[model samples]
Target: MKLFLIGYRGTGKTMIAKILATAWNCEWADSDGEIERRSGKSIAQIFSQDGEASFRKLEIEVVRDLATGPHKVVSLGGGAVMGTENRTTIAAQGLTCWLQATPATIAQRLEQDSATKSQRPDLTPLGGLEEIQTVLDQRFSVYQSCADFEFDTEGKSPNQVADEILVTVAKEQKMNS
Candidate 1:
C-alpha cells in the first residue's frame, strides 16, 4: 500500500515522506512537484496562471497516477484532499498520516522555508498567521476525517515524526497479521 502524507503546508509532509521512503526502502513522490514537472511550471505559477480549479484538476490526475504502483510514500499538496475524488482515491489506495501543528508553528515554518514564498501562492488576502488560522479552521475537520494516523509536528524533528509513523505502521501491520 502507498503511504500518503496529508496535511497543511509547512507541516513537513514532503520532508517526512523522504525520511519514510528511505526507511521503508521504497520510492516516493510529491504530488505538487509532479504537477509542476508535468505542467512545466511551479505551483505558484499554476495558481496564478491557470487558477485553483485548473490546479486541482492537475492534482487529481497526479494523485491517481501516483496511487497506481508498488508501495511508496506520497506527499500530497495541502488542499489536495478538498476534492472528493482525491480523498476517495487516497482512502481506497493508501494509508494517510496527517501531520498537524498550530497556526503559529506553521507560520514560523513557512517563513523559514525560502521555497515556500516562491513556490506556493497565498490562498487568502490575509496572509501570514491570520491566513493560516483561517485556512486551518476550514480544513481541520476534513483533515481529521481522512486521517488514519495523526501526528503533532509542533515540537518534533522530522526524523522523530517519521520514526513514530514507522512504529505505528509496524504495529498496524502486526495487528492485521
Candidate 2:
C-alpha cells in the first residue's frame, strides 16, 4: 500500500520519506519537487510569478496524479492537505501520517535549510518565527483532520522517525486486519 507523509515544511517529511523508501524498496514522490520539474520552475518561482492559487492548482494536479499511482511513499507540500479534494484523495489512496513539530523547532530547521527558503514561498506578512507560528496555527486543525496518525519529529532523527513510521503502519495494519 502507498504511504503518504503530510506535515509542515520543516517537519522532516522529505528526509523521513527517503529513509522509508529505501527501507521499503519502493518509489517515492515529492509533490513540490514534481511540480517544479513539470513546470520548469522552483516552487518560489511558481508562487511569485503565478501566485499561490496558481501554484496550488499545480499542486492539486501533482497530488492527484501521485495519489492514483502505485508510488510507495509520497511527501506532500505543506499546504496540500488544506484542500478538501486533496484530503479526500489522500484518505482514500493511502495511510496518511502527519510528521509534526513545534513552531520553534520548525524555525530552527528552516534556518538551517537555506536552499529550502528560496524554493518555498512565504505565506505570511510576518516573517521568521512569527510566520511559522501563524501558518501552523491556521493549518494545525486541517493537518490533524487529514492525518490517520501523527509522529512528532521534535528531538528525533530521520532514521528514528522512519522506524517509528514502520512500526505504526504495521500496527495499523494489524488493527485493521
Collision count for each candidate, in order: 0, 0
lDDT (tens digit, per residue) of candidate 2 on 85-177: 898889999999999998899999989997767887888889889998899989999998888889999999999999999999989889989
The residue-by-residue lDDT of candidate 1 on 1-177, one tens digit each, is 799999999999999999999999999999999999999999999999999999999999999999989999999999999899999999999899999999999999999999988899999999999999999999999999999999999899999999999999999889989
- Residue 13 CA displacement from its true place in model 2, Å: 0.5
Which candidate should be chosen as best, given lDDT against the real structure? 1
In candidate 1, which residue ranges exceed 4 Å CA deviation? none
lDDT of each: 0.95, 0.91
Q: Judge candidate 1 at residue 69 and give its lDDT.
A: 90
Residue 155 lDDT (model 1) = 96
